[model samples]
Target: MISFINVDCTFGKKAGIKNVNFTINSGDFVFLTGPSGAGKSTILRLIYMDLFPEKGKVSIRNFDSSTIRNHEIPFLRRRVGMIFQDFNLLQDRDVYENVALSLYVSHYKTREIKNRVYEVLNQVGLGHRVHFYPSELSGGEQQRVAVARAIVKEPVVLLADEPTGNLDPRVSLELINLLNKINQRGTAIIVATHNYALIPRIPNARLFQMEEGEVTKIT
Candidate 1:
């Protein structure tokens, strides 16, 4: 559901991505891997419409990235879920509220919000910690909450940027399994990370390696 054709991106004067072309199909799990500053996150941003290409084309589903309207962004975002490297939780909100915030912002029915949040919490194995504050949870638990927040809307595409960057190896493996579960349910998964060890454990995941602002697919 994601494709980039001869795309290029520059930040002010420096190049961010150049001559990058790839495709990520629906219901497929793909990994974007490379060293730091290799344009992994840049490519993810392009898919999520956070950064538009300087040239060529990018299409998510039927929406073209270059010409997407500002008003249509919210609708687009609802179909694309992003997991930041840093757990971008609302510090003051409890786990339940943090996950439910997305539904609230979308103005979903109050009752629906409660049910959906709890359902996702259960999926992520965080149902028992629903009322805990962010500070009270361990790093892995916080990351699980982030995953719950991303999936509570049942997004068609899930993009994770260095999802296991801050966790122990055991926690990292658990998170990968969670992503795999989500993929099994038919959501397309795109993970941008530098963790090479974890890549081998996932079967049928294609790799997109970036270096010097260029991307090459290594299936």
Candidate 2:
């Protein structure tokens, strides 16, 4: 569902990513692994259109980056879910409201929005925390809320950047399992992380290695 063809991204005449090419099919769970400064986050940014390549092309569900218009970004983003390590939730909003915000902005009917919110909240094991604010929950619980928010819209692809970065190993494993379950339900998942221990647990996952701005399928 996603492809990068000889893509190159440069910032201030310096290379950010070089000749990176890869394809992720629907229903696949992939891991993007590399050391610090290896362009892993750059790849995710490219996929999310936060940064466009200077050369070559990025295609998502057959929509080429060059051909995509600015007005189409909101629509495109709605089709892809992103989970960040920092748990980017609004502290003032309750968990349900945070997840519901996406659907509301997309103009989903109020009844449908509530149903979607409840479904994903239950999926993330955060249904009981629906009325809790981000600051009121534990780190793991907050991340769960973030996950619910990401999937509430039922995005076709899920891009996660260091999703377990701040969590303990046990919680990290739980999060990985949650992601696996989501992928099993057919949402393509790409997790950018340096945690190799999680890979052994996910036997069927594909691994992508990045170094010096180049990415390759190493496993």
Candidate 3:
């Protein structure tokens, strides 16, 4: 559902993807692996329309970077969930409130928002901690909360950038397993990670190895 066609997006003199061509089909598990500054995160940003290519084009479903308007970005984002390396939760808001904030911003009905938030939290194994704050939960639980927030909208594709960067090995493994479960339910997953060890845990996942802002290999 996403394709990068001969794209060259550069910034800060020398950091971005070059001539990158690939397609991520629906429900596929794809990993972007490389050292820091290798354009992995750039790919994710392109998918979400956060950054447009300077040379070619990025197409996500029907939203084309070449011609997409600013007004339509919000609509595109609703269908593309994003998880970051850092848990960007609101420390002041409870778990339920943090997850529900997105729905509220989208103007979902009050009752539906409540139900959807709880449903998603349960899916990520955070049903019992709905009332807890981010600080009250462990690192893994907090990350799960981020995942729940991302999936509560039932996005067609989920993009995670170094999602396990802050967790221990065991917790990171658990997070990957949780993502696999979410993928099984039909949401496509694209994870940009430098941790090569986590790549093997997901069977049949497509791997893209990038270098110096370009995709050097795909397996």
TM-score of each: 0.98, 0.98, 0.98
In terms of lDDT, which candidate is stronger, 1 or 3? 3
Candidate 1 residue lDDT tens string, 101-215:
9899999999999999999999999989999999999999999999999989999999999999999999999999999999999999999998998888788898888887998
Instruction: Encode model 2's per-residue lDDT on 96-185: one tens digit a residue.
Output: 899999788889999999889888989999878889988899888988888888888788899999999999999999999999999999
Q: Where in model 2 is the C-alpha error above 4 Å? A: none
User: Which residue pairs overlap in candidate 3's backbone?
Assistant: none
Error of 1 at 91 (Å): 0.9
For all candidates in order, the CA lDDT equals 0.91, 0.89, 0.94
| Clash counts for the predictions, in order | 0, 0, 0
**What would you estimate as the lDDT of candidate 1?**
0.91
Q: What is the lDDT of residue 51 in candidate 2?
A: 86
Q: Once superposed on the true structure, which residue ranges of model 1 sit more than 4 Å away at CA? A: none
- Candidate 2, residue 59: lDDT: 89
